[model samples]
Target: MTDTPSPLTYAPPALAAREDLLAAVRFDAAGLVACIAQQHDTGEVLMMAWMNREAVAETLATGRVCYYSRSRKGLWRKGETSGQLQHLVELRLDCDGDTLLALVDQLGVACHTGRRNCFYRAIRDDALTTIADPLMDPAALYGDAHKGHSHG
Candidate 1:
């Protein structure tokens, strides 16, 4: 006997209106937007990064994350240096359509200093408190800090 199909089955949209979404955002002359990376599960603000047009496209296309590195003046793939990669979950735009919020599934730590999030320091009574410790050594990720610095 042939079995009947389930009624709960659903299909995806015909096509994602990615371009329309992009057009809604306001990018600067650098073709970049201020992207805020947030932890999906915890709602914790991990870090703030920049995303150029190419970086935004790459992040959405690959599902792996991408950012515009101001210091490098190029694209930056998270975890390439520190192994603290962020996997894109969802991308959100603020009500004003100016800012971007990236909901991500992060691996290992998020901060370069090895902390779970970059916002480890909290201000209490006008005093800063080290609420969290580094998960990995900074030197292991970015090399020696005392060395010559280069800006992008």
Candidate 2:
């Protein structure tokens, strides 16, 4: 990231268009790769999802983060249905190119359950414990469209 006002990476748009970026990525046979979203300021992991080449391109083109939903078999713009959007701060590829780390300015709740993040549970003394609580009512955000999603 540069000292630019925008959170986008400091790279030429022309370079981002080249196929080398997507070509270098190693998508699985299912044409999907893991994408982890993190808060740019606090380094808090928001959530983990999958993305395809199109999703990557869209995110790079627009400052908004996008992901591929295996369930929908289509592009899943981070907070399209909900208002909690994630604007891309920076995109990083792991050394192996198998995973992605997305630094973003998370708006509102990052988790669909209205929590700040998805990892709300932890193993403490051999027991599953909730470390956080929902900040908002999930039904108000998702409209009950995606309930019972096992974040575990």
Candidate 3:
């Protein structure tokens, strides 16, 4: 990925007024909003996840990225079990206030598959292809806890 900063980079809103700011977001019927994480410096799109109100507040308060796990039905602190972590640089709301963009400083691999990001497959030459390989083994990342299991 290029190191160049795109036009998306800007001064984030102050956290002092976070509650009021968060009130403006339009969460869906499930009380969740789609969040897209991107590398703050390189502008590499990392992953897309869901975040609820509590997740959003926690992220802003702690400066650590958090998401809502629909399957587990709880707050998922990104990379809590694994060494990989995402430090929030900024969080932006989309124009419709239904989507969120998270500018983060990612540590290690961002995917449970041990890849740098989740978008590893691509449509290439009229066929689906694996564009990126795993940087580390999935077994190494999650150990026995995730053995024979796959992320949904």
Q: What are the lDDT figures for the candidates, one per model?
A: 0.74, 0.82, 0.84
Order the candidates by lDDT, highest first — what do you get? 3, 2, 1
lDDT of 3 by residue, 2-105 (tens): 34333234343477679875998899999999999999888899999999999999988877899998877889899888878898887888899999999898
Q: Least accurate stretch of 10 residues (summed lDDT) in model 3?
A: 2-11
lDDT of 1: 0.74
TM-score per prediction, in order, is 0.80, 0.87, 0.87
Q: Residue 1 deviation, candidate 1, in Å?
A: 40
Clash count, predicted structure 2: 0
Where in model 2 is the C-alpha error above 4 Å?
1-12, 15-18, 148-152
Q: Is candidate 1 or candidate 2 better by TM-score?
A: 2
Candidate 2's displacement at residue 47, Å, is: 0.7
User: Which residue pairs in candidate 2 collide?
Assistant: none
Candidate 2, 51: how far from true, in Å? Answer: 0.1
lDDT of model 2 at position 85: 89
Q: Model 2 over residues 82-140: C-alpha lDDT tens digits?
A: 88889987787899999988888899998988899999999999999998999999888
> Which residue pairs collide in model 1, if any?
71-152, 114-135
Model 2, position 106, has a per-residue lDDT of: 93
Maximum-lDDT candidate? 3
